[model samples]
Target: MTDVLLGIDQNVDRAVTQAETMLDLFDATDLDANLLHDFVDNPEGASVKQVDSVKRARDILEDAGAAVTLREGSGDPAQSILDMAEQLDVDLICIAGRKRSPAGKALFGSVSQSVILNAERPVLTCGSPGDEA
Candidate 1:
């Protein structure tokens, strides 16, 4: 049983793409995926199930026969993902990487980069559909 923590953002395309990539990369029957959505600004107290990206990802993974669980987090997105990964003891942490300029990243910070740098376990990043190399 391989456990995976799939960090889903608001990008529906990226989330679905990552889910499809996972199905192609692993045996769905042997995979257990936790779909996580972090509400960075949760004044309204949003739930993970309320996020379209997480819900779509869950549907794709579950349809492929992967055991799927929904998780919610509030705070820094990268930190939340790392904390959940540690708590779940997942074998892999998967996230979507969006292309950002160096200056943009310097100012805004990159969640994928932070998770990759700080994670104790392996982190797999899937680029968005039209991202260039």
Candidate 2:
């Protein structure tokens, strides 16, 4: 089956728009990534919100009828995202965020930018629900 990697982070709260898009765009195995801990740990209580975010996003995706496997990544967010994509050798990658102007992109380097620049596979970027083209 085709494999698709979805790179998610704290911005995941805004990923619904992109996730839904992917649902219609591809018929593939979906892999989700959350670089919550540099080292694996039990995600409980209130210590790690990132883990919680991943779980919530995973639930959302699953509820939407997309079967997603959450992958745990370590180290830099950008590197981890690429590493997971490479390791899984996914056919495509999907990430979501608000559209940024050129100046905004230059002011802050984004994970999506880094992945789009470096990943050998195709990358699908999704913007906010009401974002203009």
Candidate 3:
């Protein structure tokens, strides 16, 4: 069985697209997906399961017959995702990449870029719908 750590953010469309991509790439029966959401500024202590994007991704993966596990993290999203990937020892880490200008990325940084550069394992990234190559 191949284990996958899928980082889910606030974009429901991206999350669904990522889920569909995973289903297309691998057989559901052979995949174990860990759906993760990070609450970067949650003074209210939000749960990952409570997030709409995470829930939608979980539903899509689960409906496709993939074994799904919900995970929550607090603080930096990139670090949280990386830590979770290590903790779970997943075969691959999947994340949706946003279309950002170089200046924008430089100013704000990118979680997907950080994960890709620093990960000890393979990372799969897909551009958001309408993103140019």
List, residue by residue over 1-133, the lDDT tens digit for candidate 1: 9999999999999999889989998999999999989988989877888888988999999988999999998889999999999999999999999988898899999999999999999999998768642
Can you write out model 3's per-residue Cα lDDT over 2-51, one digit (the tens) per residue?
A: 89999999988889988999999999999999999988899987778788
Which model, 1 or 3, shows the larger lDDT?
1
Check candidate 3 and list the clashing pairs: none
lDDT of 1: 0.92
Per model, state how many residue pairs clash. Answer: 0, 0, 0
- Candidate 2, clashing residue pairs? none
TM-score of each: 0.96, 0.69, 0.95
> Lowest summed-lDDT stretch of 10 residues in model 1?
124-133
Q: Candidate 2: list runs displaced more than 4 Å.
A: 28-52, 101-103, 130-133
Native-to-model Cα distance after best TM-score fit, residue 35 in candidate 1, in Å: 0.5
Residue ranges of candidate 3 with Cα displaced over 4 Å: 131-133
* lDDT score at residue 49, model 1, on the 0-100 scale: 84
- Clash list (residue pairs), candidate 1: none
Error of 3 at 40 (Å): 0.7
Best by TM-score: 1
RMSD of each candidate relative to the true structure: 1.7, 4.8, 1.7
